[model samples]
Target: MDDASDDLPGVMRVVRGHLTETYADLIDVGDLDRRPPQVRDLSFLSRALAAQAVRILTECSAPEAAAAVTDGEGDHGIDAIAVSPNGSDIWFVQAKWSDRGRAVLGEDGALKLVAGLRRLANRHYDGVNVKINRQLTRIDEALSSPRCTVHLVAALAGGGEVTFQAEQRLTRVGQEFGFDGRTPVKVHTLGLADFHTFARLHAAPGPVQITATLTQGWHTVHTPYLAFAGSVPAGEAAAWFEAHGPHLLAPALRNTRSDRIDQAIVEQLVEEPENFWYYSNGVTLMCDSVQAQFFGRRLQGEPARLELGNARLINGARTLAAVAHAVAQHPATAEQALVPLRVICVDNAPEGFLSQLSAMPQSDSHTDLLDQVAADPQQLRIREEFAAELGKQYVFKRGAPPPAPSAGCTVQEAALALACAHRDVSLSAHTSAGLEHLFRPSPAGAYNRLFGQTPPGRQIWAVVQAHRLVQNALADIARTESPWRREVMDHGDLLISHLAFQSIGLEDIEDWVHSAQQDPDWAKQWTGDIVRSLAAAVTDRYGQSVFLASVFTDASKCRVLAEIVSRASATGNQESTANTVAPARRRRNSISVLVDHGRIPDGTRLIYRPGSPPEEAAIGDWLHENPRRYLATWVNDRQRPLIWEADQQAYSPTGLIMHIWREAGWGEAPVAVQGPARWFLPGEGTLADLAGELVRAAALDGGA
Candidate 1:
C-alpha cells in the first residue's frame, strides 16, 4: 500500500493484491464454492478496510499485531480489528467504499459501527467467528481493567460525513457501555481527507504544528541564525515522537540511524522519565518554514502553538529516541519530563549573493553550522546547477548504500574524506549536515575557511574503505588474545581509523585514495602496513596496555597519535608531548559540593559511594546534626535497619529511585524533580512515614 500506487487504478492493483495475498483467510473474503464469481464485488470494501487497519497499526507504531477482516452476511458489521501496539486501545473498524463520490454509508453505517462496538463491549464471542472471537477475548481481557481505552472507528471511502443524527446514535450506544467510567466512548471518523493526511504524516510528519505551553525561558536569535530555543515537557515531546518519530527526520537522517528506534533511549524513557530531559542533548531541527504564536496556554483550552510547514527535524535524533522510548515505557510522565529543544528551520531568506556579502558582508556566528544553507533561492539554484554538472548523487542519507559504481564513494564517506584531506566545501557542506555526531560536529559554513580545494571523489572512497577496514580490523583484534585489546576495540574505533589514515605512507590522502581507486586493490595491500606501523608507534610511545584508552579519552593524545602515524612528529616525538592535563574530577567535585555542604564533622569514617544525588548528600549532612532522629525515623517506619553497612553510608539517589520505580511494578514514573530536591522528603513515603514514627518513638523515650 505504501509503494508505487499513484492513482486509483494503481491503488486498485495493490488493493487486489492485498486481499488475495494478505487476508485471503478471512471469513469475509467469501467462499469460492458459493460466491466464487461474485468475489470481485467485495474486494474494494475488504481491501480498503484492511488498508485502514494497516494504517492504524503503522500510526500506532505497532508492527507486531495483525489486521483481520470479518465482515460477512450474518456478520456483526465489524469489518476489521486493529490491535493496539500496547493493547491500551483496540480499534474496531467499519469501512464503507462507494464507487461514486458523495454516496455514503450515512446513518446506517454509523449504526453498524455502534453495533460492532457494542459487540466488542458486550464480549459476544460466540456471535463472531474464530478469529474475531479471539480478538474479542483479548479485548475483553484488556477492558476488564479501566486503564485501556476502546476506539470505535468508521472508515469511509468517498462517503458523506457522519451526520449529527448518526453521532447522537453513537453517543447513546457509547454511554450505554460506560467504558472509561464516564461519557460516551468516542467514535473516531476517518474521512477521505484524513486518509491523505495520514499518508503525508508517514512520509514527512511535517508541515507539522507542535503546540505547548511555553514553560519559562525561551529566546529567539535573529541575527546570525534564526532559531527558537525552549524546553517542552517530556509528555509533549513524547506526543511528537509518538505521532511521527523516524518520519520526523526521514529526509535528513536518510539511513544513518537504524530502522527500529534506539533501545537505550527508550529504556531511559520507560525507566527514568523525569530525568529524560536532563539526559537529553535536546533536538535541533530544520524545517522548510516556521510560524510562531505567542499567546500560549490560555483559558478555556486555548493554547500557545507553533505552526511549522514542511517541518522535518534535522538533528537531535537521540533526544527524539528518548522521547519515543519514554512514551512507550511510561506515557504518564510525558507531560512532567520536560525536554529542551532548539528549532532551526530552513533559512529561505531573500538571496544575498556572494558579491553582496563581499561588499557589505554580514558575518554569521553559525557560519560553520549553516555553511551550506540555501541563504537565498539563488544559492540553492547555484548549488543545484553545480550538482547537475557534477552528475553525482550530490547528497545521500544515512542508510543509502555507501558505495556506487559511477560515484565511486558514498556521499558521506567521500565528503568526510575530503573534509579531512582537502577541506573541500562542495561535498563537505552536505556531508557535515548529515553526519554531525559521527565525524565530530561542525557548524556548516565553518569549513569555508579551508577553501580553494576539491578532492576527487574516487580518492575519498578509497580512504573511506581504508578507514572501515582499519576499524573492523581493530574490532577483530579486540576479539583476539591481546591484553589491551578490550580497551582498543570497545571504544574509539572510528577515532583510531581517522588517525590511522594520516599515518599511512607519507603521500597525501588524496593520492593514496586515487591509487586505491585506480588499482581496485591498493587499500587491501597498503592499509595493513599503515595499521601495523601506526599501532607500533603508539605502543612504542604509550605502551600497549595504555594505547587506546590513553588516546581517545584525551584530545592531545589523539593529535599526538595522528602525528606519530604520519611520522610528522619532529622528534618522532618518542615523548608523546603528554599535554599535562588536570585529572577528570568535574563530576566527582560537583557531587561533593551537593553532598558535602552543611556537613558537621562526625567521629565515624565517611563511606563514599561517589555519585550520590543532592538529597542523599543532604541526608549525610543532616545525619551528623541528628543521627539518632534520622536513624530512628528509618527504624520505626521500615520496621527494618536503616543502616545497610556498619558505618553510616550514603545511598545513590537514582539507585533508590530505580528501586522504588521498579518495586512499584513500573506503576508510574518517579515524580520528576523541578529543581534541587531533597531525598528524604516530607509527605507520603516510606522514608517520610518513618520520620513520623521516629518522632513518636522519641516522645515515648522522653516520657519514659
Candidate 2:
C-alpha cells in the first residue's frame, strides 16, 4: 500500500490528521514533538483507524473509544469493543489502515474475530489482557440481554467491502448468537468513503456540504449571489442536523446555549406542527456555492434539488435542534411540519459579509441574557479583573465557549455565587428560580446589587470555589439518601450554599478559602456538618411532614431555617449535628470512598497538569489556546472521574490525560499515566496524594 497510489489522497490526509490527534496515545512514537502522518508506522495508523471506527460507529467520545481498544497480546482478532452507556448495544471492531486507500478483510481475520466473540459469549476469559478483563462486566451484561444488539464492525481506511467469504463467516457467527428466532448480532462494513465523510463531519475540518429538497421554491440569480426562498420539510431540516450536528451552524455560533429556546421550539413542533411555518421564523443557510436541480419549471410548484457547498445555518439553531428532538420523540407529527427556509449562495460576496449576515438580528431570537451584560462596563471590568488578578478566563459573552471549571468562571456563575454570598435569603431564592430574573435591566435589580460595585476576582473565585465544594458535598450525601431527601438536596443547593456562605463570616472568607484549599477535606466536612444541622433546623421548625422542596424557595421560610441553623451553630451543637446524620455505606473506589466518607464530593473541579516535561511541552500551546481544556469535571466513579466538557462525557483520569496529549499532537504519549497524581485539587496536593493521606489515616484508625 503506497501513498502515491492512494485514490483518496485529500480525504486520507484529513482523516489521518484527525486520527493522529485523537489516537496518538495508542502507540509509542519516540521523543519527537510531532511527526507527519505519512511517516508513522502501519501499526500506529491502523490502531488509530480502529479507535476512530469505534468512536464513529458507537458515537462515543474520543476517550471512550480509545479506552475500548483491546488489540494487544491475547486479543484474539478483536481490535476494539464499544459498549453503549446502557449496555444495550455493543460493537466489536476490527480495522485496517491502508496507505493506498483500500483494505479488504480476509476470511481468516473474520473467522478469528468470530471466534473471539464466541469465547466472550461463552464467558471464557482465561487469556485476555487487563483491557478486555476490565470490560468483561459490560460485555457479559450486553451478551446476556435478550434486547441487546451486538455488531461486528469491519472498518477500513481503504475503499472496499469485506471479502465474500469473510461476510459469510460473519453471517454464521450471527446465527450462533441468535436466540428466540431473533438474530442479536449484525455486521457493519465501512470503507474509505464512509471514513472520509465521518472525518469531514465529526472533525469539522471544513464547512459541511448538505443536499436537500426545497418544496415550492423559487430562485433568484443576482449579479453576485443566488438566493432560494421556499418551504422545507421539517423532516429534511432535522435530517441535516442529524447528519452534521453542530457543523450545520456557522463557526462562531457553535457554543452551547440555554435549553429554554430549544424547549420552546420542541413544544411548537410537537403540539402545533402544521402551523410551525406560520408561527416560527424560518432558518437561513449561507452557502459558498449552490447547484440547483429541478424536474420541471423552477418556479411552477416543483421541488428544487439543492446541493449546497460549505453550508452554514446562520440562524435558527434552536429551531433545528428542537425539530430534531421532536422528530425523534414524535416522528409522525413532526414530519408533517413545514418550515420556512431561505438559502443564500454568496459565491462572490465581499469579505466579512457572511459574518455580518450571521450577526444580523433574526425575527425569532435565541440570544442569551448574558450577552446583554457582556458589554456592560461593570461586567467588562470584572472580566479584566479575573484575567489580571487571578490569571483566570472570565467569559461574559454569549456563544463564547466557557473556560474550564478549574481555569475560570462565567458571568452567570459569578452572579449566582455573588447572590448566594449575599446575606439575603431572597437573593438566593431569586437566583434559584431563574438566572434571567436576576439579570433584569433595572438598576435596582439583583444584577446591580451583585455586580454594581466591582468585587475582587479573588473574593469571587473563593465564593465560587466554596459553593462548588458545598455542591459536591451535597451531591455525595444525596446519593445515599431516599428519593425525597435527594430531591430536597438537589433543589435546595443554592439555599444551602447561601447558608454555608453566610455561616462563614465576611472577615473569614479568605481565611476559609486558604484553609479549605490546604486541607481539601475540611471544606467537605464543614459543609456536611452545616447540611446536617440545616436538615435538623428544618425538621425542628417545619415538622418532618413538611415538604422541604417548597420551603427552600420561599424567602421567609428560608430565613427561619437560616435562623434555626445559625442559632444551633452559635450554641455549639456541632456534635449533635454530626450525630443526627446516618452513616453511609463504604465504597471500594478511592474517589467514591472519598465521597462516601464526606472527604470529596461530586462536581469538584480538578486541574489536569501535564505529568511529564515532554508532555507539557507538547500540550502547553494547545491548553493555552483554550484554557477550558485544562480542567475536567470530577465525578465519584469507580474507574473514571473526569468529565470532558467537549462532549459532556466521562473519561478516566488517565484516559482523559491521554486524550489531551493526543489532541495536543504529542507524538509520544505514554501508555500509562499516574492519573490521580496529575489531577490537583487547587491548593491541596494531587488526587494521588490525597487518596494516600486517606489510606494512611484509615490504617492509623484501624490500628487504634
User: Could you tell me which residue pairs clash in candidate 2?
Assistant: 101-158, 404-628
Q: How many clashing pairs per prediction, in order?
A: 25, 2
Could you tell me every candidate's TM-score relative to the true structure? 0.33, 0.36
lDDT of 2 by residue, 350-409 (tens): 879876887755434325446667768867887887888689988888878989999998
Q: For this target, which candidate reaches the highest lDDT against the unseen true structure?
A: 2
Count backbone clashes in candidate 1: 25
RMSD of each: 25.0, 23.3
Q: What is the lDDT of residue 227 in candidate 2?
A: 82
* Off by more than 4 A, model 2: 1-46, 54-231, 241-268, 272-282, 288-322, 351-369, 372-526, 530-704
lDDT of each: 0.45, 0.71
The number of the candidate with the highest TM-score is: 2
